[model samples]
Each structure stands twice: as structure tokens, then as C-alpha cells.
Target: MMTFDPLGDGISRVEHLDHMGDDLRVVNAARISFDRESHLECDDTGQWLQDQDEKLIGFLAENEHVSPFFHPQICLRITMPSFLAHQWWRSTVGVSRSEVYRRYVVAEPQCYQPPHWRLRAQQPKAGSGTGELGAERQAALSVEVERLYRDIRTLYGQMIQEGVAPELAQAVLPQATYTRWIETGSLHYFVRACGLHTGPMAQRELRLYAEAVSEIVGGLFPVSWKALTRHTAA
Candidate 1:
């Protein structure tokens, strides 16, 4: 029995499959139950586990193309920053994002780990990379960034301890700090707005998020994803 941990990835779980049409509706509903019960502590844990195993097998039993459900839409939760979120929000095609509010629900800020390749000589103003840096340079930059991150976290904790409101304290946090949002959109809208036609840099983070969404949707609506990808690429 190979148990899988969904939370290990930034993507936790996907639940909406009404977007994959009636043919997949029954199995998608079953999957929702399976996912929920699997996470819950049922008294008959063995039976619950067995049920999920059977449901998974059944879900994979059929291999027929079906019309994709376009109206209901799918929602994805993504962790990114205000700036990236701003960039993502620019696409007017069917995408909607609800982000963490600075006005409420404040906590210690989250952040992104920059790829190690960005530290060399600041690169061209246009931000193109020449090549990788040596180990010595990488190591030095890593140490400095880690130290700064640690210090910021420490200061954040101290401010909280000293009775600063989390919203106010978060002012000290960098724009690089992580934020999260729930993005919802139709498959056509999502794929078109986030497709390869978009500039590589403009779409980077959202593209990764879109890819994850595509994986889930593609699993249920393979033909639709393929069509959408083709259209976008074309």
C-alpha cells in the first residue's frame, strides 16, 4: 500500500470536478467523499480506507471522452505575493482571485525562496541571466539571505511580543513575503489567459499554478485540456 501525502506539495488538495461534465460527476463526487473521509478520523478506519481504495479503482475503470463542464468553474488556492497577485489579476479572462487581507487575519508573513541563480552581479537591468555562479558565491549569498530572513523573523516575533498589532507589524515585512489567494475560473478562460502566448516572465508563478490546475483538470477532462493547450499554443 503506497500512501501518499498531498500536503507535501504547495498544492494541498483539489475538490471541484463538476467542471468535467456529468460523466465524471459521479466519480468526482465520490472522490470528494473519499478525500474528506480519508482526512477525518472515522471509527471504522479500515472500512474507510478500503472504501477509498475501491472508489479510486472504480474512478479509473472508464476511459471515455466526455463534454467538459464549463459553467461551474474550478477554484485553486495559490500562495504568492501581492506583486505577483497583482500581475495575475491583470488578465481579464474569467479569472478571479481573493487574497489574504492586510486588514484582517494577520499572522507572521510568509515569503518566497529566490532561486540561487539571481545573486550574481544583479544581471542585466532587463533581468536576463548569463550563467550560474560559482559555489563560493552561491554559498556566501545563501548565508547572507538566511541571516537576514532570520533577523526579520526575530524582529517580527519581538514586535508581536511587544503588543504590536499583527497588521501593523506586518508593515515591516518585505513584498517578497508570501500571501495566498483563492483563484476561480472556467477552464477555457484560465488556460487562455495563462497560456504559452503570455510572456514567460509575466506568467511564471501563475504558469506554475496554472500547470497544477491543468494537471487536476486534465485528469478529469483530458480532451479539453489538450484542446485548450493547442488553442493557446496556436
Candidate 2:
């Protein structure tokens, strides 16, 4: 599970890419209110990331009809694999991610909250849908998940006692293992990337996260956010 923190100082400026010709003074005010600096250091590496973000924003502004919005930084707490994290990093979006390290942070038995909508079909080969399991079934699945989680943790401890390397034993960890990260980015890229991953009736956890970001950005830049939301929803 990821946690969120308020954006701090010197990092609250909002960048706008709009062709609407409206002054958007109201939106600008909101941006000023929502802006915050990320905790990450602004070293050479950080400067490079910021440069890339500016380049992308400039490109979109010059070429695309849709306006874009970006805060100086974004904070995201996400739990995903190193592999997936690498993919996200490639976007060159101005977002920062912080994750737990196996070397520095001790591994704990992983727990995952089952999606409420997955009840009707515990294993949807085609993927999640609106159909969900009944209350009775959901309760049963919850018990099973808890039971399995405890069992897995116990086994992991036993493996350690038997001299298994932590890294090797970690391989048995399930994908559902919860992880957290903090990501920061331009609203333009954030919305675009999220739109690509989401479909109707997205998983509640991810959808809620996306929606929260959307709401934040939308409140800051109403016109641009509205257009983006309408386009994505359509």
C-alpha cells in the first residue's frame, strides 16, 4: 500500500499548455494553491529529469491541440516490480517513485486486498468486469487470502531458518504483495499514461489513485482537466 504526502515548497508552480486563448486566470490560481516541492534532491540527475519533462511539455504544446498541465513535481507511492518501475521511468515524466528495498528494508509477509468486483469470478481469464461475487463468496475469499498470507509468511520464516537466502526466498512472493511508491509528474502525462492502463471498471485501488490525481489536477486547471477527462471518458 502506497502513502501520499503533501507537495512542499519551491515546487508548486503549475505549467500550462493551452491553445484555448482564454486567460485561465482561475485555473492558474488553483495551481498556485496546489503546488508543492517533492522531497527528492535536485541534483544533476534530478535536473536532467526536469529538463526532459520541460522538453516533453514544450513538444506537446507546440504540436498538440490539447492543452497540458504540470506541477513542478508529483509524488506517487506505488508497489510494483523493479521491472515495471523501469518501464515507468522510461516515460521521462517528472514523477518520483520511492519503493522498499530488500537490502535496506526487511521483507514482510505480503498481503493483498482482493478486488471486490472479482467475487463473481475469482479468476477472470479475460480480466475484471462489473460482475462480482456475492457477499458470502467474497467473505470466503477474504478468509482464504488471510489464511494463505499467514501460511506464506510462516513458510518464508522456515526457509530462512533452513539457510535460504532472502533473495531466493523472496522469489516465492506473490504478485499481490503490496508495495508503495511516490510518483510526481505533469498532469498532462499523468492523465495520458493512466488512460492507457485503465478501462471501464478498473480495479478500485488503481482507479481510486488515478481519480484522486485527476481530481487534484482538475481542481488546479479546470478547463484543461475537463477536456482531458471528457476525451478519456469518451
Candidate 3:
């Protein structure tokens, strides 16, 4: 399987779908400034082919000349809870997405059960911390959660069995339902997204998702990924 289990319980996944271009492509795109094409003009030097190309990519990143990063594109298949998907969609600016539609396909009803219940953030606006409510309260919350999930699932199944349209039946699904989508964008966009989703302020679930994506992006473009991170730090 191409999928990586970023979040256990099979609730969240990040799969490398397809990609185009590469580190050299980003370098060549910027090399156009000199009215030169690396592919046509550069000689093939087996081991030293990209010696200076690395420096050029680093230079582009350092100076915030990010357009070259757009030369490389990547597509990912992601399966995440709807809550995380909502955050992901909000963070996306330069990416294209195609999500599975319930109108055509029945959504697999799955709800995320948190490892532990968390008390609301004290900050009043964001974040979550450990629950102050003792083990008994935590257990109580878990029990209620399971009951709610069962009820929702029962209703959804009943509707389907009654010949209700899948689209209408989907309305009863919970926010924890896993949704799948193909997200395609330039390497630059993915990097930018990583910067945000991996930050301290982002949602925890989405941050985990972003970290998984970064692993794939980094493996594909090591030098470029380094340059992007260095620039992002600055």
C-alpha cells in the first residue's frame, strides 16, 4: 500500500498519488533568467550533474524567489476526518482537489474516538489541554461518545436499508466520518501548507496530517525541501 498510517486506527492516511518535475526542474525554471536551458545546454556529468544546481535552488529560496518552486508538482491521496478536511480546505490556496461524493458512492461511516477526552482550552479561543475531570469523568465521556456513535450508525444503516438515497442518508453522518480526496499542487504550495499546518497554532489532527505529507515531499526533493525549510525559518 502507498498509504502511511499517520494516525492510528486507520482514520487518517497520506498516500503519494503522482508527481511531476523535480529539484532539477525547479533549478532549470529559474535558470531561464540567464536565457539558458539546462537540459539542452548542460553536459551530462554522471556524478556531478547537480553540483551547482543545488546552490541555485538554495539561492532562489533564500531570496524568497518562490516561483521556481512551482515548477515541481505533486498530487496526494488523503483520507482524513471531515473536521480535519475542513481545516485542510481552508488552508489550501494553490491546490486543486477532487473529493469523493456521497451522491455517487456511499461514505464509509467511521467516527474518530479520541484517545482521551480533553478539557476545553483555557485561552477561550483555541487549543486543548489534558482533561482536569478525573478518570471517572473521562470514562463517562467515552461511554456517551460510543453510544452517540452507535445511534448515528444505526440510523444511517436503517435509512439505507429503507431505500433512502445515499446522498440523503449521508446527512446523518458525524463530522468524524473519514473523507478521501486527491489534492494536487505545486511543491511550493505544499511547502507553504506544511509551514502553516505544522505550526504550533494549527489543529492537532491537521498538524499530524501535514507532518505525514512533509515526509513524502522531503523524500522526493531533499535539497529543495531543505532550502524551503531554511527559507521558511527565516
Candidate 4:
């Protein structure tokens, strides 16, 4: 399946829809600087292989000349909690997003229900801590969350029946509500995104999504992906 279960949350997924360009695109983009392009300019059969110029790619990467990486773009369809989507929305460069609108469609409501709930960070109002809630507490929380969503869905449908605008009705849903969107971005953007989200500050769920992205993008643009990420994350 194209769908990826990054956190193993059944409601969330990341699906690679399509992609454009390749390593040669990067090579040609770079060579364009000197009015040159890499194609079948040589009779050597190896020249027809990937990367075309490994040293040149490495040089560009080591020197941080990454504009060529922008030539390749990847598309993904992601389903995640609205809160996590808010975090991703911060990435506004070299990427575009088109999301499912609640006002237009009355899709079934779903929410993220982690098997083990995370504890709040030690510092006041920071991110989550390394530990998880005890199994007993986790079970209790699940029950409460299920009840809460059940009530929310009931209220939302009631409002819709009473002729309340769908937009206003959707406002009743919390950040935990699941949302879906289409994301398209350059190779460099995905690499940078994976690097950042896999870091300490990002949420655990978002980091998992980024790891899924790294796996796909890394496979798509192995050499250039490595150059940008340096294998430090994912």
C-alpha cells in the first residue's frame, strides 16, 4: 500500500502520490551554470547510469549549492490530526498544500488515539516528556476520549440538522480531529523538513511522519537526499 502508518495510528497515513525529476535533473540543473548538460554525451555505458557525476553532486552538496535539488518535486497525500497539521503548516517555503475542507464535505469524524499517552514535558508548558502514561491511566484516558468524540460527533450532526452552517459546525471540533491534505514540495524542502521534524523540538507524531517522508524521499533521490540530510536523522 502507498499508505504509511508512521505512528501506527490507524487514522493517520502518508501516501506518495507522485514525483518529478531525478538525480540527473539535479546534475543538469547544476551544469546549466556553465551552459552544459549531462545526457548521453559519452559512449561509455556507465555514463547512462544514475547520478551521472557523483563527484559533482558531492561537491555541490558539500559546498551547500543546493538550488539544483529544488528541481525535483514530490507529492504526498497525508492524513493526520489537525494539531499536527498546524505544525506542518509552518513550512511555507518551496511547498504547496491543498486540504480537505470540512464545510464542503461531511466526512466521518476520526481522532488520534495513541496506545500509550505521553506525559507533559518536565519544563512548564513545553513539549511532551520521554515517558508514557501508565497502562491503567492510558486505558482511562482512552475511555474519556472516546466519550468526548462521541459527544462531539453527536452535537455536530445535531447542529447540521438544525441548519447550522457547516463551517460553524466544524468549529466545534478540536485540534485532535483528523484532517487530510495534499502536499507537494521540492526535494530540498523534504530533506530539510525531515531534518527539522526528526529533531528534538518537533512532536513525536510529526517526527514519525517526517521519518516516513525521509524513507520515501531518500529512496527517490538517494545521493542528493544523503547530501542534504547527511544521514543525521531518519
Q: What is the model-wide C-alpha lDDT for candidate 4?
A: 0.83
Candidate 1, run of 10 with poorest lDDT: 1-10
- Error of model 4, residue 186, in angstroms: 0.6
Model 4: lDDT of residue 113: 72
Better TM-score candidate (1, 3): 3
TM-score of each: 0.61, 0.56, 0.89, 0.90
| Residue-by-residue lDDT tens digits, candidate 2, 10-116 | 21112222222121322332334458322212765542223333343334444543333553334444444343344444555544455565534445754555546
141-212: candidate 4 lDDT, tens digit per residue: 899998998999899889888988898899999788999999999988887778878887778888999988
Q: Which residue ranges in model 4 land beyond 4 Å of their true spot?
A: 40-52, 124-126, 231-234
Off by over 4 Å in 1: 1-72, 81-83, 119-126, 196-207
Which is better, 1 or 4, measured by TM-score? Answer: 4
Q: What's model 2's lDDT at 53?
A: 35
lDDT of 3 by residue, 10-43 (tens): 6678999889987888888988898766542355
| Per-residue error (Å), model 3, residue 30 | 0.6
Backbone clashes in model 1, listed as residue pairs: 110-178, 111-178
TM-score for candidate 4, residues paired by index: 0.90
What is candidate 3's CA lDDT for residue 166? 94
Please tell me which model should have the higher lDDT, number 2 or number 3. 3
lDDT of 1 at 33: 47
Between candidates 2 and 4, name the one with more favorable TM-score. Answer: 4
